[model samples]
Target: MKIVDVICTPGLTGFYFDDQRAIKKGAGHDGFTYTGDTVTEGFTQVRQKGESISVMFILEDGQVSHGDCAAVQYSGAGGRDPLFLAQDFIPVIEKEIAPKLIGREITSFKAMAEEFDKMTVNGNRLHTAIRYGISQAILDAVAKTQKLTMAEVIRNEYNPGAELLPVAVFAQSGDDRYDNVDKMIIKEADVLPHALINHVEDKLGAKGEKLLEYVKWLRDRIIKLRVREDYAPIFHIDVYGTIGAAFDVNIKAMADYIQTLAEAANPFHLRIEGPMDVEDRQKQMEAMRDLRAELDGRGLSVELVADEWCNTVQDVKFFTDNKAGHMVQIKTPDLGGVNNIADAIMYCKANGMGAYCGGTCNETNRSAEVTTNIGIACGAKQVLAKPGMGVDEGMMIVKNEMNRVLALAGRRK
Candidate 1:
């Protein structure tokens, strides 16, 4: 079969899943507020609009599939300008990528992926979001074409018997209100096991002792989860730069906190992520090294995933060279393109480092699925998105595909 046609579905929306409900100074009490206002003297507010984008693919054999391509709310090239990215890319899919594939073979996923990559490159400036759209639409189309589930494809290609356990992530909202340190810990601890136990008490309040109790309670909850689940589902922490620990001075405290988390975590498995205010590459690596050393001394394993600190290839190298961190938390756009993100993952893998695909709060369904494809191609072990992972339509597409693949292999069993 040859390529046939690509069409973009109209409608795009923005949604904010900020854990913090209070306005925050984006930087150093910067006084940025999201009062649902258009303009605030020193605050950056979100209009909280409902915008969405979807696309349709018509294959050569008269087959068709529809899916979302919006990356997290403000994703892709011009993030804050989703309307523009959608305006520009939707046309490309309709006029360029779709038309070329109208008569092409759809038997090979790799071939289809390559075709899109080539098309993207030829366009001079390729946006991963565009390629993401093609990859996702085709995956849906191919799954339909072959009548094979997405999990089946993954199992056949990668981890055949691997089950996709529930992934728990600490959700972050732009506002800081939801970040009441103790409440955040308790809520996350309750995520996987609210039925059995509610970590927070009826008259519970926040204080130093209460905070310590909350941490210890979180630890117990983590350990209990490990004991109950056959496979230890991974837990992700989104610091969101809320940790007031200064890199140079508070490295010990950071390490201590991690150690407490690791010990309380019965299965002894935990991964922590942050966009800490380390300021620069050298400082970031140093902080990681110190934290890693502290964790090692306590026989606790930690995968220090870098978020904001890793903006480019050079940044990745610094972390790898110094063994500052064991995992590279890649934000899709920061790697420039999907292929570039793939290269970074490959590099990390070759060096025996783990890589995770992460996203910000403002992601749409279209973009999430695209990021899912990117994660698969880049060899990511897992992904970190909102806890209500598949709420977005874009994410739902990938989630459906993964479920299909897993179901086909009986992994869900």
Candidate 2:
């Protein structure tokens, strides 16, 4: 199908605020200074905000598909504004990206995405929001044309012989470093502190030493409540790199911090993300290598996940190729489009590294649905439920989509 027209609309997904008192090194932003007990980087408790741009992909066949831009809010750990960045999508997609796509054969999402990357502003890559909007619109239009699930289209287009396995649903509980808990609470929360079905307030709310104590509580609670009687829940925590930050980026101190969590999550290995975020990619990789070595040297089963600065597919591959981190996240928006994202996940698989397909609560059901398929088609370790604050809502959207895709695939077989 050829692209016919592209339209954009900008609006607030929800209100969001950040105090930047992230427990660990502040996953997205590194320079966290303390004002008494709290971090001083934009410290405030006003209501947080989330904004998104709606994209309509019009094809020559009169078929219209939808997409959304606006990755997770906290991606600013790289020092960028998501909402402000989202505003650029309207002009960029309408003026720059749309021109290249109109009347072009979009049978290959991968091909068109490459062209979109070439639509840079003054040698700078398009802002993630712009890329995300353009990428999703293309993918949505392609999927609509194929009469298949998004995951099915992804599997057919990329990752030949790829298994559509059940992507593990990672429940994001409690608070985020950049999220304001007091103001961002969901009125329909079945699980308090988390919109999903887990209670991790003690684990996430505690600071410093209390982190250890609360983690133990979190472990026991997960085992008792979340896991089956015969099964142990794998304890996965995104540390926000505060452990490394608190330890002054000392490898031993950071490893020691992880060891404590490892011990707390005994019998089940702990998967930890954002141990540290350094000034540059080299320093970040160096920190990753050092921390991984320390964890290995101590015989800790803690898996060090690289999230900070591993923003793009190249970044993820760099981490995987160097063995810098045990797991590298294929952050969907960072990879620009899902087609590029699938290849990155395949890269992780080919290299024997763990791949986590993740997104932020700052997305919509449409975006979450698309990534859920990408995660399954690429055989990722897990996919984060997102597009909204409630964990249950994110989980519901992604999990339901996975179920639908698999069922349809079965019938096709």
RMSD in order of candidates: 7.3, 6.2
lDDT (Cα, tens digit) per residue for candidate 1, span 117-217: 55644646445556545566666676677766542443344433444443232233222222332333433331221111111221112111332344455
**Candidate 2 wrongly placed segments (more than 4 Å):** 14-48, 75-88, 121-124, 176-208
Q: Cα deviation of 268 in candidate 1 (Å)? A: 5.8
TM-score for candidate 1: 0.65
- Give the poorly placed runs of model 1, Cα more than 4 Å off: 12-14, 17-33, 36-45, 73-85, 105-108, 111-124, 141-147, 150-213, 220-235, 244-250, 260-268, 311-322, 332-350, 364-380, 385-403, 410-413
TM-score of every candidate relative to the true structure: 0.65, 0.81
Q: Write the per-residue lDDT of candidate 2 for residues 1-413, one digit (tens) a residue.
A: 77788777876653243434352433343343222233424433222466678888788889888777765655444654333344555776677677776787767667766677456777887777667767777777777888777777788777777667787776565445113222212222111222121122433332246566655665565455542454454556676666666777888877877788788867666787777768689789889988888888888787888987788888888888888889887777666666677888889989988988886666777778888888888788878766565455676787789999999987887
